[model samples]
Target: MISVGGYYCSGRSNGHHLQGVAMVISNRLQSSVVEFTPVDECIMVMRLKLAFGFMSLIVVYAPTDVCKLDVKEMLHAKVASVLDRCPQRDICVVLGDFNVVSGCDRAGYEMSVGPHGSGADAGSKNRLLFRDFARSQKLRISGSWYQRPNPLRWMWYSDVGNAAKKIDHILVSTRWRILQNCRVYRSAVVPIINWLWLPSGSISKLPSGPMITLGCFPWTG
Candidate 1:
């Protein structure tokens, strides 16, 4: 565990220098952290003691769209195994840059996606895989639950500034009402990132739940 500016960070570095995943918790809630496990360079798990039971947080940097299908499936399988081991009573949240565009069509995926996604109508291989994973796990895409402008949904942009894609996402348990709002901030000099605010009283006694941030960086195939 490492502390920086009153925040505790946990993660695994695979020596690639360009790939890794981490979770940062505010010092105010440091006492709540009961376990932190680094699954791999691309995944990390953190458990926090909550008023009711526990909150399991999985931070992941999934394979890009260009990667082979088998490679992408492997990461999802690893995440699934981790989720299976969590306590049934724990609040599970899977958040990260999944690098897939889960379009707004809720057709058969009513359990996983909401009514407000922005992307391709006909699902791509990556999109379909991501959606199936969420559906199988009974998790909802947090950003799609709340309505936002289409532009705000785009989480990645091209270097030429002519194209943008909604790849980064935060998936939460379909049963929890913890997230109040999710906002994306676009900057000319930095890659897009999302800020999620947990409303007061959502997480039992923890009135001020930890604010979660998901960031996406440019990647080349």
Candidate 2:
């Protein structure tokens, strides 16, 4: 099982540039690709889950630097709300372009050279919240276990990693043991990336990352 998502951040207009709004993947979550007249910037979250029999894989996505603590809380809450409602007969895989960083607890350094010198203070508290939440829920981060720049994606911006960080992720539940393989997809020319798991068969990361056509994500169980 696999899932993919693209989040549209209501980030300052300076962060993202766009003309009109359209094609909302999850209107129920109040996400939009375009802002309607002085409205809040739209946001999106995508998840992929591979269930041996009945497990669920949740998609993950978040806006960049949401200052209001209450809003941040709601962001996490809404994601949790969706995941909770999903069936738990199988394991879960939550991942995607999370604007914030979550703390990791597996072992040593996961991503070696991010070009951005550790990205420590870039949402340290939010990272802690994720770390604590993962501990409480028994979820494991997939890519980190490798301890290498496992899946390197090119950022549209400069190589400073300033425009990018290991913000995207693929988190799985502990119960799902025998499964562990993740990869990043990037276009030979495009700087953006897409994350894939179970990574077998016809998948390559040499630029031209995982080319996903239908932008819409799959529904998890």
TM-score of each: 0.80, 0.52
User: 1-221, model 2: which lDDT tens digit per residue?
Assistant: 11124333232355444421112233332331222122123333333232123334344445456566566667667667655765666445555545555433333323321222224544466765555555556665554454445235322344675565556555666655543344444542211213333334332222222332212221111
Candidate 1 off by > 4 Å: 1-18, 187-221
Residues 55-134, model 1: lDDT tens digits: 88887788888999999999999999999999898888887779888788999999888888768868388889999999
Best by TM-score: 1
Candidate lDDT values, in order: 0.71, 0.41
Model 2 poorest ten-residue lDDT run: 212-221
lDDT of model 1 at position 21? 65
What number of backbone clashes does candidate 2 have, counting pairs of residues 3 or more apart or in separate chains? 16
Model 1: which ten-residue window has the lowest total lDDT?
Answer: 188-197
What CA root-mean-square deviation does each model show from the true structure?
4.3, 10.6
